[model samples]
Target: MKNLNRKNAIVMGIGLLMLSVAQIAAHYNPNMPDSYKGFFMGTGLGIMILGLIKNKPKRAS
Candidate 1:
């Protein structure tokens, strides 16, 4: 928790939202395509990776 900052938090939040949408759509909408769910899942994972990468502490060169 201490390592998390505002920017990282926002990015993670967005990723979480995307994942939630995918989950909800999976259960509620039979008409929703698998491709859309895959897209959201992939995008959410990518966003979280980016956030984690950005959250890494820089070392002095």
Candidate 2:
């Protein structure tokens, strides 16, 4: 299995941190709107996806 590059690893870490922050914020404020939570969750997922993705190798003709 290939290992993640330093930049990708950092991006994943930031995404995880954002996810945790969203959860904690929601927990502390029960009245938080679903939209706000969804925004953070979605953004985190997107960031994580970017971090996990690798470039596809080009096939020689």
Candidate 3:
């Protein structure tokens, strides 16, 4: 909770959401275009990485 914040939560939520959506789409509908799938995975991973960075606790200077 300490490291969690509004922005981080939002980013993590959206990132994970996209990933989940992508997964479900692929599982439920296997005929999806490869380009969109790659885009979803790429953006999702990038956003989650950003969330991880934002969620890290910073040392007080």
lDDT of 1 by residue, 1-61 (tens): 6879899989989998899989998889988899999999999989988888899877999
The digit string of per-residue lDDT tens for model 3 on 8-44 reads 9899889999998898898888899988888998899
In candidate 2, clashing pairs total 0
Relative to the unseen true structure, what is the C-alpha lDDT of residue 35 in candidate 2, on a scale of 0 to 100? 99
What would you estimate as the lDDT of candidate 2?
A: 0.83
Q: What lDDT does candidate 2 reach at residue 19? A: 91
TM-scores for all candidates? 0.85, 0.83, 0.75
**Taking the tens digit of each residue's C-alpha lDDT, what string does model 2 give over 2-42?**
65677778888898988999999999999999999999988
Q: List the residue pairs that clash in candidate 2.
A: none
Question: Model 3, 47: alpha-carbon shift in Å?
Answer: 0.7
| Each prediction's number of clashing residue pairs | 0, 0, 0
Candidate with better lDDT, 1 vs 2: 1
Best by lDDT: 1
Location of the lowest summed lDDT over 10 successive residues in candidate 3: 1-10
**Could you give me the TM-score of model 1 versus the true structure?**
0.85
**True-structure lDDT of candidate 3:** 0.87
